[model samples]
Target: MTSLLFVDDETKLLRILSSYFTKKGFVVHTASTGEEARSKLRDADARIIFLDLRLSDATGIELLQEFVPRYPNKLFVIMTAYSDVESAVTAMKAGAFDYVSKPAKMDELEIIIRRACEWLDMKQENRTLKEKISKMMQDQEMIGVSPAMKRVFRMVERAAETDATVLLEGESGTGKSRIARMIHRWSDRKNQPFVSVNCAALPEQLLESELFGYEKGAFTGAHAKRKGKFEAARNGTIFLDEIGEISLPLQAKLLQVVQEKSFMPLGSNQTVHVDVRIIAATNRDLKTMVEEGLFREDLYYRLNIIDIFIPPLRERKEDIPPLIEQFLDKQRAKYNKPFTLPPELIDRLVEYPWPGNVRELENAVERAVVLCRDEQLSIEDFPREIRHAKPDRPPSDIALDPTKSLPEQLESIEKKLILDALEQTGGQIAAAARLLSISRQRLMYKMNKYSIR
Candidate 1:
């Protein structure tokens, strides 16, 4: 249900609007002061707010300025008096969803509310997409056709079918977090919220409170009771990225949630039961941490139920060309610019040892797109490290023809390289992976991904 907030000093007006909305099947909340409205906005989890132009505490535009940024999830609708209509324009400039005259009829107000909710949702979705494919960060879009990637696919497929606790193990930039999202999308809980939190981003106590939420007066600044990520992700999935970074104490708390499916908010004995699937990803080896007495053994076992390991990019050089092509396509579409990669650049990129894996590859691509203006990108357009790095393999013949797309040309070269490595190594996976400077697991996956076997 969409919660609507109306903040006005007029008690009679608030009472009338509240009654009307409540009768119209909307959850209506009215606040007579700015402070009260803030509390109600948090408590009601309001998506849309309507504030009068003049409040006893502050101007409506001032409140809009404060609320819009703080609650990116919520939209504010400014209600300005007809005489001082200029303030409404100011409110819109301050990121207000829409402005309305003081004497808006019930039907007109209803129309405005509908449009406001839709606009807010659209903006939020676009922001999410940009964040996902920004290249510098994590998001879905796994590009690989190596045997190493095929094994990953098989594991992800198995994990997605069940509501089992999944632990994605890999180094940073190998796309562990993205694999978690893929499992969620494939699961029955796809329609529900998929909340993700970086366990390493927050300190121990704060991280605990964030995961479990807190009751009112639970601690300082606990002005109102707040629901945590677990609660918000009820009937969905909660991805705990960098799970191994959490403290031992928090690990025990997390263990309880996994076992009992219930947890207590900070400073409260009352336990809240949650029906959320936990998807954890970590770059750290929890077994070593457990042996070192840093991570809890019980928690480790619980999360390791269905482990999916992602190999580093260097271990799967065969995947680079497709990844490069994917990035190029994304950048071209994003900037609405035509981009072409020269043959030497593709050979250089594939030969360079990508220490940062796919994440580094994306950053390099984004950098080139930003600085490049020529018809085709060359070695000069890439980073100094990439441009100067020594190749582990011979240069690929990716540019003998300019007609093929990046992926097509890349695939042709990758196939030839794999064929040469296999023939040179007498069909040994380990030796082939080493000669290619990729992991054995990745080599096997790539064999399956490319039908190299």
Candidate 2:
């Protein structure tokens, strides 16, 4: 049933209106003073409140300001005498949903109540529709076709169906954050908040406060009580990015939350329980860190329940063309122009090792779009490193046999080039990556992709 509250100074009017609304199938509440109204509101959780412009202890405008921000979903109707129409207008400006002159007719009040209900219904429908559209947009934003990416997508779909703790391991700029958001959007708690925290970005103390929140006067500068990310996430998802960077001590605290789903805030002994779904991501290997005594084994095992490895862009070369096209489309729409890339430039981008993964490819596309003088983007539009990049081995330089298929021949050449680079650098990954014009992470990813090491 819908709830209606009337805050009026006159008991007789409140009684009459309450009786009328009760007959109209509303769970009605009445308060004769500001204090009484606040109490009734807390108890009733009214959907619509009829507040008098002149309360016994406080003005309706004062209450409206206090309630509007706190109860944005609730509607407030101001009541005033005909002579106090100006005051009603002020109350409306202060967040009153509507204003009715004193001696309000039953028919007029009924109409306003109906309109408010309709407004609320429409707002809810709009919010739901927006969430659907946002999820669809995010689904389209993930561009991938490689087998490695296909596996990631399959894992994501499976992970999203459950509440298992997900640990996304990948190189930096490999879109782990985007993958986390996708998992949240596809999960049962999509409608709830998705709070993200970069563990590497904050100090241990500040990170603790941010994750678990603090009570008022908890610390020297903690002047007000604040909810932590876990509290904010509540029944939704909390993404802990760069989880490997958190100190071992902090990991023990986090493990308590992961294992028990409860944590005490700073300066408070009260344990706050949360139904949050935990999703953590890291570029560093948590298992190795655990073995090295830099990370907690229990926490690592808890988070590793549903492990997902996001392949670097270098390992998923087939996904490059579509990723570039997606970035190009975004830039074209953003700039309101039709920009084109030549086939040669596209092939160059496809072959060049993207050290920074998808993120670098996106930046390069945007750069080309912004700097291109003409409709067609040229090689000169790219960064100096990309422009001057020489292929690891020319086709003629590599020994090719006529008996092998094109793909097989290409694979042979790629393997040889990597072996040559590794030998030249004396097995140093960083030096080999530099010689190959790729990132160290990308080089390692390629090695794993081809089982080179």
Winning candidate number (TM-score): 2
Candidate 2 versus truth, CA RMSD in Å, comes to: 26.0
Tens-digit lDDT string for candidate 1 (1-453): 778999999999999999999898889999999989888977887788998878888888888888988998887888777786567667767887666677778886887777666767867755644443343224435766677876786687678899999999998999887788888876899899999999989998789888999999998989999888899999999999999898877888899999999999998999899999999999998999999999898999999899999999988888898788888888888988888897778877878888888899999999998888675787788899987888686675445668888887778788788889999866755457668976545667778878887
Residue 453 lDDT in candidate 1: 74
Q: Model 1: what TM-score?
A: 0.57
Q: Kindly list the per-residue Cα lDDT of model 2 for residues 1-453, writing each as its tens digit.
A: 889999999999999999999999999999999999889888887999999978779988899999889898899999888788677667766877777777999987987788778778867865654564445456764767677876787688789999999999999989999889988988899999999999999999999999999999999999999999999999999999999999988999999999999999999999999999999999998878988999999999999999999998988888888788788888888888888888888888888888999999999988888888988899999999899998654455666589999998887877788889999866766457767876545777888878998
Compared with the true structure, all predictions reach lDDT values of 0.83, 0.87
Return model 1's CA RMSD, one decimal: 23.9
The reply for model 2, stretches above 4 Å from the true place, is: 1-140, 394-453
